[model samples]
Target: MKVSLIFPKLPETSTFIGTVKEAEKYSKDKIEFYGFPPMGILYLATYLREKNFDVSILDQFARGYSVERTLKWIKQENPDVLGFSTITTAGTGIISAEISRRVKEEINPNIKILFGNYHATFNDRRILEKYPFVDACIRGEGEKTLLEIAEKVEKDQNFEEIKGLTYRDNGRIVRNDDRPRIENMDTLPFPDRNLLGNVEYKNTVEGLELSVGKFTSAASSRGCAFQCSFCSSSMFWGKWRPRSPENIIDELSILEDQGFNNLLWVDDNFTISKKRLLKLSDLIRKEKFDFNWMAEGRVTQSSKELLNAMKQMGCKILSFGVESGSQRLLEWYNKKITLNQVYDAVKNSKKVGIDMILANFIVGAPIETREEIIETLNFSLKLDIDFPQFHILGIIPGNWIWDQMVKEKKINPDDCWEVGTAVLPIPLSEIMERIRQTHIKFMKRPSYISRQIAKTLKSRYRQKAVLQNIKNIERWDIWNSWKPFWG
Candidate 1:
C-alpha cells in the first residue's frame, strides 16, 4: 500500500500571540531557516518502507503548506492510507482532524486515516468518538504498530487484535491493549534521514537561529526518568531508555557524513545520567567526528566534570529546566532541584565555555500570585544565562497538572483536548502581560546588546542569528509581546 505520513501544517495565525517576525503566516518557513524535522514521522515512513510498502513523508510545518495546499498534495498522491503525527500545541489535533474529515468526505471515502504521537496516544477514544473519519490511533512507539496496521489495511482486515490501537467498531470505539514500550533502543533502525527529502532543517533556540549550516536533531534517549507535573514526556514515552554510546556515536557519524554539522539532542533530559554522558562524550571524541550539539539537561546533573566533558566534545548549548523561581512552585511541579542548583548549573555552564546557556522558566502556576510571578521574572533576569524562555503555565493532557484540573472541574475532560490555560488560579492574560514586560526589559538592556555584539564577533553562527534579528528589528514580536508559550 502507498502510505503518506504528515506533520499537520500550522494555522495561519493564533489568538494568543504573534510570530517573532510578522508575516502572512503564523510561523516561519523552512526556507527562512526555521523549524525542526518531524523526527517521529520519519521513523514511521522508514519502517514502513523497509517492510516493502511505498511510503512518503510530508513535513507540512517545515514545508509551510496551508491546509488547502496540503489537501491538494494529498489528493494528487491519493495514497491507500493516510497517517498523521500530531502534538498538543497550536491546535494540531484539531487541524489533523479537519484534514482527516475532509480527506474521507471529499477526497476518498475508501482511504484509512490513522493518528499517532502524544495527542493521539492519550486521547484515542475522544478522537475516534468525535471524528468518525479517523480510522485509528497507534498509541506509543508506532514503528511496529504502524507496520501491523498497514498490513491489516492492505488485506482488508479488522484491527481488533492489534495491540496499541484504538479504532471504531461498527459504531463504537474499541481500544485494544496498549503495546509495551520498546525496550531495546538499538533494535529500531536508525531513522532514514534521506526520507526527509531535500528539506533544510535549522536549529533555532529562543527565537534565535544561533546555529549555522545544515541542522537536524538526534535522540540519544527516549522518555524521562522524572515526571514533571506540567510535562507529558514521561507519560508519552513510558520510562527511560537510552541508546548505547556506540549506537549514538554511529548516528552522529552518519549525520556528519550527510553534511549535517549541527544538531539538537531532543531527549527530554540529555544529562539524566552523568556517567552515561561522560561515556558518550568519550566515544564521540574517539570517533573524531565534527558535529556541534545542544541538549536539555537537569540542574542536578550539572556537575563541573560533566559540563567540562560535554564542552570538550563540542556541546555548544546547554539548557536547563529551571521551571520556576519560587521554591514552592518548583516542588509543586515535582521538579526536585532547588533555585541554588539552577544558579550553580548556569554559572558552571558559562565557566565551561558553553556558548549558549538557556533556562526554561514556567510562570503563573495555579496558586501563583502576581508578586510570585514577578519574582520568577526577576529570577530569570538575574540568571547569568543568555536566553530565558518564560512560559505561561499550561495544563496539558496525560500530565499531573491536567489530571488535577479535570478532578477540580476546571477543564472538561472530553471537550478540552487542547492545552487548558483557563485554570484561572491566575488569569492567563495577566501572566502574558508580565511575560511580555519581562521580555522587553531583558531585550532592551545595554548589557544584552553588548553581549550580543561580543558573541557575534566570537562566532559566525551567532553573527548570522544576530543579523536575522537585526533585519526583523522593526517587526520583532517581543515589542508586540510574543509570549513564546505554544500551549
Candidate 2:
C-alpha cells in the first residue's frame, strides 16, 4: 500500500524565536536558516519502507510546502492511506484536520486518514468526535500497529479488528486494547535517510559541523528516566529503555559514512546509565570516526571522568537542563539534583574543554512566587555557562502536574490551550511580566554582554552576516508576540 506521512509547521511565536536564537548564539559557527525537521514522520516512513510499503515523508516546515502542494501531491501519488503524528497541545491535529478536509473536498473523498502520537493517544474520542473524516487513531508506538493497519487497508479488511486503535463505528467511537511496547530496540530498522533527499539540514549556527555535513537531525537512545512533572516523554515511552551502545555506534558509523559530521543525540537522558555511556565513549574513540556529536545530559551525570571520555569521543557541547536555581522550586518539581551538582557539572565540563549551554529558569509553574522567581534569576547569574535559555513554562498535556491541577481545581479542565496564565493562583499578566523581566535581566548580565562584545570583535565578518540575515527577517517584539498557551 502506498502511504504518506505529514508533519506540520509551527506557528510564529516569540518563545519559539527566542529558543532558536539562544541555540544559534551558543554555537561556534555562523547560523544558517532552516526549520525543524519532523523526525517522527521520518521514523514512521522508515518503518513502513522497511516493511516494503511504498512510503514518503512530507515536512511542510522545511520544504515550505503548502496545502495546495500537499493536495497536488496527494492527487499525483494517490496514496491509499495518510498518517499524521502530533504532540500534546501542539495544534497539529487542528492543522491536519484542515488539510484533510480540503483533501476530501478537492482531491479524493475516499482517502483514509490516521492520527497518532501523544495527543491522539490521550484524546482520541475528542478528536474523532470533532473530525469525522479521520478514519482511525493509533495509540502509543505506531511501528507495528501502522503496518497492521496498512495490511488491513490493502486487503480491504475490517479495521476494527486491529489492536491499539480507535475508530468510529455506527456514529460511536470504539477503542481497542493497548498494544505491548517493543522490548528489543534492535528489531527496528535504521531510519530511512533516503526519504530526506538532498535537503540541507543546518541549524541557525554555521560553524558547527554535523556528521552528515548536509542535514542536521537527531537519533535518540532511551527516553527520559526522571519525571519532572512538566515533561511528556514519560507519557509516551514510559520511563527509559537504554539502547545498546553497539547499536548507537553502528548508527553513528553509518551516518558518518553518509557524510554526516555533526550528530545531535536527542535523548532526554543520554547519560543515565554510566556503564553504557562509558562503554559508548570507548567504542567511539576506538572507531576513530571523524564525527562530532552533542547531547543533552543532566547536571548530576557530568562526572569528571565521564566528561573527559565524552570530549575524547568528539563531544563538543553538553546541554544541561538546570531548570531552576531555587532549591525550593527544584524540590517542589521533583528534580532530584541539587544546586551543587549544577556547579560541579559546569566546572567538570569546562575542565574537559567542552562548551556548556545551561537550560535554565523555566518560569510560571504552580506554587512559584515573585520572590522565588528572583531567587532563580540570581542563581542563573552566578552560574558559569556559555549561554543560558530562559523560557516560561509550558504546561503540556498528560503531565502529572496537569492532572494535579485538574484535581485541585487550579485551572478549568477544558481550558488547556491558554498559555499566558499560570494554572495556579497567580494572575496571567503578572506571570508574563515576571518572565519578561527575568529574560531581560539575563540578557543584560555582565557575562552575556561581554560574550556578545567578544563575539562581535572576534568574528566581525560572521557577525555582520548574522546581523544582515536578522535584519532581512521580521523581528517580533519580545513581549508583544508572546503566547501563554498553545493556540
In the range 1-487, model 2's lDDT, one tens digit per residue, is 7999877544443134312332244344433334445667777788888889999877655555567787786788788898878655556666778788887788777788889888788778777988888888998888888999889889988777788899887788899988877777777777866686544454433222222244455655646778887776877777587678888788887887787776677788777878888898888889987666667889888898988888788775568888887888888788898999999998888778674344556766778887776677677777767556565676656777777777887777566532222454366677666665655666667878886566456643335545644653442232333332211
lDDT at 482, model 2: 35
The sequence of per-residue lDDT tens digits that candidate 1 reaches over residues 38-103 is 779987898888889999888777666778888998998889989998776556778899988889
- Which ranges in model 1 have alpha carbons more than 4 Å from their true place? 13-33, 451-487
State the local distance difference test value for candidate 1: 0.80
For each of the candidates, give the backbone clash count.
Answer: 0, 19
| Residue 375 lDDT in candidate 2 | 73
List the candidates' TM-scores in order.
0.91, 0.85
Error of 1 at 260 (Å): 0.4
What's the distance in Å from true for residue 113, model 1?
0.6
Tell me the whole-model lDDT of each prediction, alpha carbons only. 0.80, 0.70
**Candidate 2: deviation at residue 453, Å?**
8.3
